[model samples]
Target: MATKKLRRSAMLGRVVAATATLGLVAGLAACGSDSTSSNPTTDSPTASDISGELNILVSSADASDKAFGEVVDAFNAKYPNAKATLNSVPNDTYPTTKSAQLTAGKVDIFVVKTFREMPDYAVDSTSEDVQLAQSGGLLDLTDEAFMKNYTPSVLDSQAIGGRQFAVPTGNSYVTGLYYNKKIFADNGIEAPTTWTELQSAVSTLEGAGVTAFGIGGKDTWPAGLVMNGVVGGLYPTAADKQALTDSLWDQSASLDSGVPLEVLQKTQWVFDHAQKNFSGAGYDDMPAAFANGDFAILPDGTWNQPTIDTAVAGAFEYGYIPFPASDNAADNKYLNGKIELQLGVSAATKNKDAALAFLDLFSSKDVYTKFVATSGFSSAQPDIEQSEFLNSITDITSQFEPVWESIWIANANAGDAAAYPFNYPALKPLGSDDAAAAAAAANSAWTAAF
Candidate 1:
């Protein structure tokens, strides 16, 4: 916390704007479809060569759902006989759904987000992705030609045990709060950079007979997301977050006290001002509710912009800002992002060639550029022109700081409170217990493992 200013300065900068001309990557384009012609060349497969059913499963994020569809359509176009279909499951149920699909061998390509660092506590919570990769349930794409199309730095960040099992589709900043510009302009309130200012804005909105925040708490993760935003402000740097995690594991930290408890307090502030019965609100309905001016702010990730845009349909202008969960402005200056929507091929796929071909075509500059543009994700591939929405958020996104969820490893065997570390479900409005009770319960469960 003391070094936040230094950290912010170190991170503030422009995103790498690729100036290179768009063309087939010299070596990486060998397996990728020819950019100039759809017909086959000597170096590449013909339209009929790679033909089979290619089904991709990913957790639902409206923009990503469509961007993935772009790849499927392209694959179908290049290989007319090939059938590629995209299926999305809700985030809350994706794990079980993905596992069932993988067990049945119904999925070819699926989203993979795992703990690449593999912390000590991670063993209890090993993801299906990690297990698949470790046990060879995932197709190895380490030497794939299309893998060369991505930014090397992005690829390096995703590598597990010096190997790549998944392709990073694009990057996303998740700590953003989508606000109604019309509501703010009418209320004469600006984006808050500190907790005090955030409270002021909330009070003013309440005085104007408007709900301060709209959240989809029925799905559970949305309210939990506020704790994540608070964690970002509490610990701004990777070193700071990593140190906190180490402290927790080494018995030097307690969830009921210090920074961990602070995260819950700040998160509760958000829940306290949310629209009535938001705990019962469906995640799917928030976009339309926000567009109808039901609430002034919607805590969301950048990936939802395209969906919100469609829902808003010019009814009102909306803007996104990092959630201000701290008392210090510098701590809340930047949005934390993750190498999101990474995809990998299933080892059980009866059509491995088709899966590889889809990834090859999907990663090419020509196809990837349009994918990023429509997916509402920041370009993961270098030099792709950013969409207008991405450009609008450059002030906060110029430097990439990984989110708390990306940094901290949860203990699966721990109680709900110790598991997420914040335990938002135990707090009022969302639950019957208060912060103190929740934190105490967390300390109880957390200490049991040690």
Candidate 2:
């Protein structure tokens, strides 16, 4: 899992234009309502019994992963009428393995990670295994009640062409920056409010023989995050942010808008100036280096807070700030994130009520509180009181709420066929040159393609 924060200011407002360009496809829109009829009459005799077993599958590194066995035990304790067996697979093979099980009719529930590079946009985009699963009459979870608890963005992801399919699990996976407070204090650097100051700060750190920015070009997603968030950071106005987000979703909204170009330039500049081997560094490597003080600054998200907090053991001092961009004080902005992981009920499960009940269990105050406290992640449900860690994330997210609403929320390009975003990595290269004409041409090609 990625453990890095985006620049706090730009974190909320910033729209990841690059991710739009990447062309990574995942499942789409949720629609239709749950049927009131109990099991179609044609499908054998309906069982009156509500008690049955459901198989739940998820990607690796989940907080409840190692302890999921215990969570299942706890669940069984509370609901003796229902039982769920847990199955976890390493991220790399999850798509195929899970698909096979679903096709073979061996699994009942599925949990997918949205930010994973090759996201499963739909059950069957490129993989035959996924196709097999879809061919087996898997249920689409449009009408499940658990969906009522989700925020709009989470709901949007599940609705493909107005049809609901998946339920978003974790809250939006945020991206931002983390800086060593000691480095800023020792160098007499106030957190840079504008791009110019940001550049100067990095220069000072470099001159001091300290790596100023931890650039992880090797991990394409984080690198792309910096590039996209830059667009939001530099253009603080809601209208401008919205324009960018709109452009990403609706390519015709604008052409070669200056903000995206600026963002791309900033990313390239950081990559060019940062550690020599940054291009080869992975996401974990960059944060590990930052935690060790190998680098004074890192562009990441709240997800990494747990690891950093653990690594420093409270000895390392750090602070959250927006990603730097060339903007006046009035233009300085914060980008808010939506959710990182998504959860949904199985469409094909014979035990629809049981599945919904399980999801409801996951969303309960008790489970939510425990999950957020232990995971250092925020809750998507409005009812839950955010944990201390999530509270900090909320505070930061609140600062850029306007940007998020304008750019990310309103201007989402997720379903825009023309945007052609396959994944963040693929999109980053398209914007790499940072040339105005190049961007324009890219946008034009995108518009033409879809």
Candidate 3:
């Protein structure tokens, strides 16, 4: 079981975009009011007692798709009269597809990531999910019996105004590296606990005739993961990161200097030690590259462990650890994460009973264990059995620390770097500019918005 935190240190806004379908959402908002929008049928039924056709839609992920499928299979098995179907769309098309389905009244359960609150400076800002929820487009699961299966603290952090709308199936720790255990032992270096030690380990690995890091820069987001690791280490607490955001928003901070500069420089250092042409390398290729001992470290989310294991094929042992960005080991103990597979029952859903029943089945201890394990996500329920890989990183995940991605909302008016708010993409081989120059450009864009 993941050591449950009594409370999340902070809760932040969800990144907003996918605006093409906002019109469909707004136009169909009133249509969803007829049924199960706010108050669904009060009678809650177990799988065996409910009978209705169900359609579930979600964003695509290699592991998540498989897990949702298994849950649906179990739902069918348990609910004899239930006919449930899942449509997992590619991430690129998921938003549009979900909107299209909702407009057509074809989806029951769908994925949702939205704001419970906005920054003080942006009081009126809203995301697509916020709009959907406000427009009566989602069923409120606040008082649902199935929701009790999750940890109260976890649910509280995701709730808006004390009302829960989505079910967090699980989450993933993202601010860390997947290191080859054999490579570390062979190099006479243990997992580093400080920024200096990590730099030394990188040197030791490179001295042993190996690339220090393997990043899938071609896909872009993988490289961004390294930046997240840097931020997590430099600003180890929610208060620290929030202060930085406040300073930036008030024009009291600059990305080109202070800790922000350190973030850029350290991430640049990581990329510098990576395999040649890493920027051109594909994310799908890194697992095999590490499996073949092409690199000593791979910085990524825990969600990729199962995929990486498939490539490793039992050739070498690997462990995931916090990146240790700070000089103090104690400060780097927590791993930053974001909730994954958050499920919302569409107000437009016609089969409310079956949809609610399926969620009920999915939340049960035995079924959720299988779903989370198959999904490669950290368990969201307290006292629930965590997957073996999750168990390995229990030291870091003992605390519930939301990642900067989850806590920081991107400024739409700012340039690309400000969106990431780090500009890892603009540095070095990923782009033509050097780290300092990239940070300067990002600073300029961020400042212009002020």
Candidate 4:
């Protein structure tokens, strides 16, 4: 049972990470009497005026509890009168536990993955931060001084109708193709810049009897990484991608359309060429496999970097790049980027002053920087210097185009289809015809939902 629980936690973490990397729903327009239009600067209380026991809820899988524990300790030192406790829950139970706590008014603050997942706790509440502000379930922080420390664009992304409900923490670049430097060099293969080139490289590696790519297909979410990586490059622009999602939601888009079909085809290609028995492999197996030089590439996000490094003990070099999804260099240049985690205050907390103070401290330049740097995630605060691991991927990530997830995918009533394209199951067979049929079935389901 212990091993089973651990496996479930790992799977939950991968699913959450994948959603952070690939799932995005259009922001709902803010509505309700509680909407924050202007900065409520004067309403915020000073640190000394606040005092109470503050409880924070976060996932245990990513070492988030330890990182936030350090911040909580620092916060207590500044406001010695107030006490803060970190409640680290297993990733598999976080959402349900958070929801129960929120409904019971027992949680003072909580970690939010994306606005998209919030509605499950409060039916009338929308995932958009602004809508959340209007729902009266979250405290308005627009006027807070600490908010000014972040890049305006970063804060803006979390806003709904111009009211910020959450503070963005880490910048997540999902859908990266992490390659073994030594393996590629030994094969005389340069990083591919086009789909054709990528295919050629895969063939070359396969001919030499080396696994070209490593996948944890049994986990399901890892398989979707290929689809997410391809979709961004296929559309390559916010406007183009938005239009496609809109069409999809309205039943006007077809599975055979240029971008959708291509995404399905590429996903099938990857599955067909992955390491032996990939369908039975687990997520925890990939990093060790790649680190041991058993596979030339692993399709995943920066979240895996720490695990990969630990697995190899830094014995060989590895690098990341956006998956080259198209032959057109211009079209295949985007990365799927989003905030991996966020922090927000509960409106139901009796200790509102203490909650605000704690949030302020968490967002302070000193605390925020230390947390992000130590966690090895890219910072949302412009002034916080990113870790060396993040800096290494900046050249490719800097050129990222908007991913479709953040533009027009519907939440609220759309269910799982809102988070990921359901057609991915079809690609498990790794056949082009099977992929095409699955895409069509997914399109039909989406159309019915919309």
What is the RMSD, in Å, between candidate 3 and the native fold over all Cα?
Answer: 5.6
Query: What TM-score do all the candidates reach, one by one?
Result: 0.72, 0.67, 0.84, 0.79
Better of 3 and 4 by lDDT: 3
* lDDT values for all models: 0.74, 0.54, 0.79, 0.67
lDDT of 4 at 273: 85
| Tens-digit lDDT track of model 4 for 1-450 | 001111223334544543442211112122112442324444445557767898888877555566788888987887777888889899778877876676566777888754643223222323333334555657777877778877675665566557777877667767689998888888888988788899999988988888898888886667777777788777776567766765665567766556787788788888888887787788888888888888899998777788888987878888887888888876766566666568877666667667777777777777887888776667776646676778776665554343445554443344332235536755654323466777776666555654
Evaluated against the true structure, the overall lDDT of model 4 is: 0.67
What TM-score does candidate 2 reach?
0.67
Scanning candidate 3 in windows of ten residues, the lowest lDDT window is 1-10
Question: Who is ahead in TM-score, 1 or 3?
Answer: 3
> Any idea what lDDT model 1 has?
0.74
lDDT of 2 by residue, 272-390 (tens): 66676666787767657887888887877666777767776676678776676655744544544555445544444566666655665665567756665555556655556765555
Ordered by lDDT, highest first, the candidates read 3, 1, 4, 2
What ranges in model 2 sit over 4 Å off? 2-50, 62-64, 97-105, 112-165, 172-174, 203-210, 219-221, 234-257, 280-282, 326-338, 374-376, 382-388, 398-450
